[model samples]
Each structure stands twice: as structure tokens, then as C-alpha cells.
Target: MGTSFQDKSALVIGRPSGIARAVVEAALAEGAEVVAAGRDAQKLRDGYGDAVRAETVDVTDDASIQALAARLGPVDHVVTTASARARGLLGDLDRESLLQSFNTKVIGPAMLAKHLSITESFTLFSGVAAFKPAVGYLGVAITNGAADFLTRSLSLEMAPVRVNAISPGVIDTGIWDALGEPGKAEYFEHFRTHNPARRIGTVEDIAQAVVFAMTNRFLTGVTLRVDGGEPLT
Candidate 1:
């Protein structure tokens, strides 16, 4: 059976931008009462207006996540796109950066599962880095891989409440804004030639996939790859 969010409630944790923002918009369009949670309350309010209830949350802190859970009561779906970027070669990595990366990408969501009274499902954000490990993305690969494992484990433990991970490939989510216009264009062109889809993924692609994972009755303990077939290459 398929799921609809006509009257359901969803909590999205992460910055109110990029793929996270797209997910919030999509959820609202589907009639879900959405709550946008992140470290920036004002940013959330500014980005989403009154369409979503902006709540502050620091996923790295257990207390913060628990407190937010208490405030929201129960929710039908929980989607955490929260992450911290730690880029460096394995030998050059620092202990603090590595731990912080794991704390945000893996441990944070694990803690949410422990505390939140979720009624339906929990969808975590993994990435293509987990599969196609790059030179400077060692820390990201490790944390994302761990998150995928955590999702599977939680699916078994959480039972009736489904758990899954969405591993998105190189998407044009403006996360590459740091690359500047020229660099961003080059990046996409490189992927455009190589990826099987011959194009980059989009925020809408990921958002729709997330909704599917949340509503699909029998999909749990799985990592849905929204990558443009990059891993296969």
C-alpha cells in the first residue's frame, strides 16, 4: 500500500536549504503538517514562513533532540537530512573532525530513534560517498556508510516503525555554491558525461524518494540510492 501525508505530521532536521528545504516544501505540498528543525530558528522561519513550524534543534546534542521530541509529541514521519562536512585524506584527518562528522551524520539520528516517539517511519540522509569513496571524502564515506548500517539495524530494532536511508548522488542542490559559478558548471559537466543518467540529480528527485520511503508500507532496512547511477560506473 502507498502512504499519503494529507493529515500527517513530519519533522525535518537540517538547515533550511538545499535538499532539506526542498523536502520541506514537498511535504507541505502533500498536505503534511511540517516542522522545520535546525540550529537556526530565524533562518527556518524566513525560508519557510508560516507554512512550517520552525523549531530549533542541535542533532549533535542528545538533550536538544530529546527536548524537541518532547515538545512535538508524536509525529508520523521523521526525516533527518542533518550532516557535518569533514573533508580530508584519511592520514590528514583529525580526531575531533572525524568524531563530529559521525556525531552529526550517524549518532545524531541514532539518538533521535532512541528518543522520538515516531508513529510511522524515520528516513535518514546518506550519500553516494558511502559507495564511491573519494580521496578527500574519507570522513564523509565513513560516516555515511555507518549511517546506512545504523538505518538497517534500527529497522530491525524499531520494527513496526520503519527505518530507511536515502543515498543521493551528485545532485545540483546548490550545495556546490562554494564552487562558484564556473567551478559548479565544470563539476556538473563532468558528471553529465559520466553518469548513466547523463545529468545530475535534483532536490525534487530526493524529496519524492524520501516521501516514498516514508509512505511505502513494506520498505525498511534498505538504502534507496537516488544517485544518477554513479556508483555503477
Candidate 2:
């Protein structure tokens, strides 16, 4: 394959999740030195080993993100999978719930781009919710929509740092554990019928999309949807 991240280092956040892990792994596999960060230091270490430098980071906190950026040194790329799993309809969602979710996904990644001198490319996680709305997903849609706009706008101000977002649909990233058994089963059944792919997404699938955007050099201020054509149908 051709080089996408030639002679560069990458700083990846939220390495605990499958999608984040895959992005870090793909960056490494592409010959980039990775400095991976997550809330769980031991987990990052355990998951990535010595080949990937690990840092303890909570993306929701400014200090934690600053410390992470400082530790990672100058980087040629930045990517985040730092969102929390919280879902509710607007009527049922409280201020704290909304803020907490945005704090992780919206504010966190935006702060990273503002504070850190990310290289030519920066990638943040959006979701299909940004465009295709569903019931009980108002909070996610708002936060992700905000993130998409922020990513695009930041790309202009950040200049050479081409900022973009990835909108993945229903990736089977063990995040379903938060939904409990019944909710999880319900989600699977819903996707089995509604999604065009007839299955859930893999982390590697999202990872490859991220890697493509980061290294493509021409893509910026865009949200690449890796949803297996679910939104089309």
C-alpha cells in the first residue's frame, strides 16, 4: 500500500474501545509511531503493549487532555474515540446528562484541537446520528452535529491541520454492554432488519476509514460515513 502517514507520529485518544484500538493499530501498521491515551492507563498498556506509548487521559477534562498532548510530543495526526455512551430523548434528558455527553464528545475533542498543535490532520468521532435522527437519540444527534460543525470550522482556522470527523453506524464495540441485555438484544434485532448490511459494523471497518482520511491529504472538513449503506435504505 502507498504511504499515508509518512515519517510522522500520531497521538490517538480513547484507546480502550475497539474502534480506537483499530485506529491506533492501523496507524502503527502504517509505520507511524503512536502515543495512545485513554482513561485507563493499564488497559492502554495491556492493549497496545510497548510498541505503542500509553498515557492516562480522560478526554472530558482539560488538564488531562493537556497533559496527554504534552506527553505525546509534536504529532502529525490526532484521532479520538473519546465519547461516552448516554442516550435519551429530549423530554427525558436532563441538563447534566446532556452536558456530560457533550463534555466528552463535543467539548473534549474541540479542546484538543484548540490546545494541541495537531499536525496536518485531525480526526474526531461523529456518528450517523448527526444526520439520520432516531427516537431517544436527540442528545447524540445534537452533540455529533455540533462536533461535525466544529470539525469543519476548525479546519479553516487550524489551517494545515485538516480537521475531519468519522460517522460510523452501529459498530459492535462492546459499548452495547451499557445498554443491558434486553436493550442490547433490541438494538441487534432492530439493526438486523433496518441496516442494509444486515449486521453490525466492526472496529476495523471504522479504523480503515479513519486511516484513509488521515492520510489522504486532500480530505478535510468532511464527515465520512462508514455505515455500510444503512442510511441509504
Candidate 2 lDDT, 150-177, residue by residue in tens: 8888889888778889999988878788
Runs off by more than 4 Å, candidate 1: 1-3
Q: In model 2, which regions exceed 4 Å deviation?
A: 1-3, 178-186
Judging by TM-score against the true structure, name the best candidate: 1
TM per candidate comes to 0.97, 0.91
**Deviation (Å) of 19 in candidate 1:** 0.5
State the C-alpha lDDT per candidate: 0.92, 0.84
Name the TM-score of candidate 2. 0.91
